[model samples]
Target: MANTPQSKKRARQNERRYAVNKARRSRIRTYLRKVEEAIAAGDKDAAAVALRAAQPELMRGVTKGVMHKNTVSRKLSRLSARVKALG
Candidate 1:
C-alpha cells in the first residue's frame, strides 16, 4: 500500500507504464511469431522481410526500456540465424 501522495502517484504511473510495456512486448512477440511462421514455411524471402520489419520494433523495445539491449541483440541474432538456415 502506498501511504504517501508521491508513492500513490508513482503507483499509478507504474501501472500505466506496465500496460504500455505489455502491449509493446506483445507487439514484438507477434512480429517474432511472423518471422517464425515464415521460416517454418521455408520461405526465406518472407522470413527476411519479417525480420526487417521486426528489427525496428525490437530495437524500439530497447529504446523504450521494455527490453534490454543485449536481450534484443541475442533475439535478433537467433532469428537471423534461423532465417539464414531457412534456405
Candidate 2:
C-alpha cells in the first residue's frame, strides 16, 4: 500500500529494477548453462571458451548489484577448476 507519492514512485522503480535484474539473471544462467553443456558433452575447448565468455557477464552482474561479488568469485573458481580438470 504505497499511499505516499514518494513511496509509489519507489514501488514503480522497484518493479522496473526487478524486471531488469530478472532478465540479467536469466542471461547469466544461459551463459552458465552453455558452459555446463559443453562440459557435459566433454568438449574442453568449448567449455573453456564458454567459461571465458561467461566470466565477464558474471562480473558485470556483480558490478550491477544483481549478484554478490563472492558468489560470482566462488562460481568462477569452481567452474574454472572444473574446466581445467576436463581433459
Candidate 3:
C-alpha cells in the first residue's frame, strides 16, 4: 500500500516507467509487424527495407531495458534470415 513516503515515490516512478516502457514495446512491435506484413506480402525488397528499419528500433528496445540483448539478437537473426530467403 506504499505507507512510507519513499515507497510512494517509488510507486509513482514505477508507474511512469511502466508507461514509457509499454510505449516503447508497442513501438517495437509495430516495427516488427511491418516486417512481418512485408514478408507475408512476398515483397523481398519491402521486407528487407522493413527489417532494416526495425533493426535499430529493436536494438533501442534492448538499450532502453524494454527487451533483452539476446532476445533482440535472435529476433534480428531470424527475421533477416526469412527476409533473405524471400529472394
Candidate 4:
C-alpha cells in the first residue's frame, strides 16, 4: 500500500522500530515479573534486589520511548512501596 518510495522506506523503518520496541517491552515485562515473583514468594531480600534491578530497566524503557515517564514513575513508586512494606 506504500506507493511512494518515501512511504515504502518509512514502512520498512517502522517495521524495524516495531521489532526493537517489542523486544524492549518484553524485556521490561520480564524484569517486572521477576520482582512480582519475588514479592509473591515473600522473600523481601530477593524482592528488593529484583526491584533494584528492574528500576533501571523500567527507566530505560522510558528513555527509549517504549514507555511514558509518568507511567514508569508510578510503577517504580508502587513497586518500591510494596518492597518496603515487605520489611
Candidate 5:
C-alpha cells in the first residue's frame, strides 16, 4: 500500500514499533496479573511486594509511550487501594 520509498520505510518502522509495543504491553499485563493474583489470594504481604514490583514496569510502559500516564496512575491508585484494603 505504501507506494513511495519514505512511506514504505515508515510502514516497516511502524511494524517494528508495533511488535515492540505489543511485547511491552504483554509484559506489563503479566506484572498486573501477579499483583491481582496476590490480592485475590488475600496475602497482604505478597500483594504489597507484587505491587512494588509492578510499579516500575507500569511506569516504564508510561514512559515508553506504550501506555498513557493517567491510565497508569489510575491503575496504580486502584491496585494500591485494593492492596491496602487486604489488611
Candidate 6:
C-alpha cells in the first residue's frame, strides 16, 4: 500500500517499533501480574517485595512511552494500597 519509498520506510519503522513496544508492554504486564498474584495470595511480605520489584519496571514502561505516566502512577498507588492493606 505504501507506493512512496518514504512511506515504505515509515511502515517498516512502525513495524519495528510495534514489535518493541509490544514486547515492552508484555514485560510490564508480567511484572504487574506477579504483584497481583502476590497480593491475591495475601502474603504481605511477598507482596511488598513484588511491588518493589515492579515499581521500576512500571516506571520504565512510562519512560519508554509504552504506558502513560498517570496510568503507571495510578497503578502504583492502587497496588501499594492493596499491599499495605494486606498486612
Residue 58 displacement in candidate 5 (angstroms): 0.5
Off by over 4 Å in 4: none
* Candidate 2 similarity to native, TM-score: 0.98
lDDT of 1 by residue, 13-78 (tens): 999999999999999999999999999999999999999999999999999999999999999999
User: Could you tell me the C-alpha RMSD of candidate 6 in Å?
Assistant: 0.5
Which ten contiguous residues of candidate 6 have the minimum total lDDT? 26-35
lDDT for position 79 in model 1: 95
| Count of clashes, each model | 0, 0, 0, 0, 0, 0
Reference-based lDDT, residue 70, model 6: 100
lDDT of 3 by residue, 1-87 (tens): 999999999999999999999999999999999999999999999999999999999999999999999999999999999999998
For candidate 4, lDDT tens digit of each residue in 1-87? Answer: 999999999999999999999999999999999999998999999999999999999999999999999999999999999989997
Whole-model alpha-carbon lDDT for candidate 1: 0.97
Q: Give per-residue lDDT, candidate 4, residue 61.
A: 97
**RMSD in angstroms, all models?**
0.8, 0.5, 0.4, 0.4, 0.5, 0.5
lDDT of 2: 0.98
lDDT of each: 0.97, 0.98, 0.97, 0.97, 0.98, 0.95
The true-versus-predicted C-alpha distance at residue 60 of model 5, in Å, is: 0.5
TM-score of every model? 0.95, 0.98, 0.99, 0.98, 0.98, 0.98
Off by over 4 Å in 1: none
Residue 19 miss distance in model 5 (angstroms) = 0.3
> On a 0 to 1 TM-score scale, where does candidate 5 land against the true structure?
0.98
